[model samples]
Target: MSPVPDHGEESYIGSDRLKGRKALITGGDSGIGRAAAIAYAREGADVVISYLPEEQSDADQVLEYIKKSGVKGLEFGRPP
Candidate 1:
């Protein structure tokens, strides 16, 4: 499968080595967290992302990308 274009880079969906694996990302809403989420999704890993309440949009974008990679993308929150 071909990789989808994102942030000027292309993500290959079929080249994922982590297919079926699950990962939890502490800051998966933005910055390094978002990058890691995309990479993991490309590698076929299901992702659980935690982010601040204010970062919902960022987290949603990352989760959307993860879903495009045909993997599960779960997002939660950082308790106050």
Candidate 2:
């Protein structure tokens, strides 16, 4: 099967609309959830992402991007 396509990786300019906000996102290891986490961070919000343990690698990547936004980033793993 083909890997899921995620267009959220495209560069997005943030306007600080979500500044000082905290976001909790599920299924954030990939796809739309990952994209939202990136967007939220760029918008100046702390981000927490939850996903299946199997998706830890992907979640790590998203967390890196989130941290680059100069906001806090957290990862939660659910039992498979």
Please name the candidate that would achieve the greatest TM-score relative to the true structure.
Answer: 2
Off by over 4 Å in 1: 1-14, 78-80
Cα lDDT tens digits for candidate 2, 17-59: 9999999999988878988889898899999999998888888
Candidates' C-alpha lDDT: 0.80, 0.86
For every model shown, the clashing-pair count is 2, 0
lDDT of 1: 0.80
Error of 2 at 45 (Å): 0.7
TM-score of 1: 0.79
RMSD of each: 5.8, 2.7
Instruction: For each candidate, give its TM-score against the true structure.
Output: 0.79, 0.85
Flag regions of model 2 displaced more than 4 Å: 1-7, 78-80
Residue 66 alpha-carbon offset, candidate 1, angstroms: 0.5
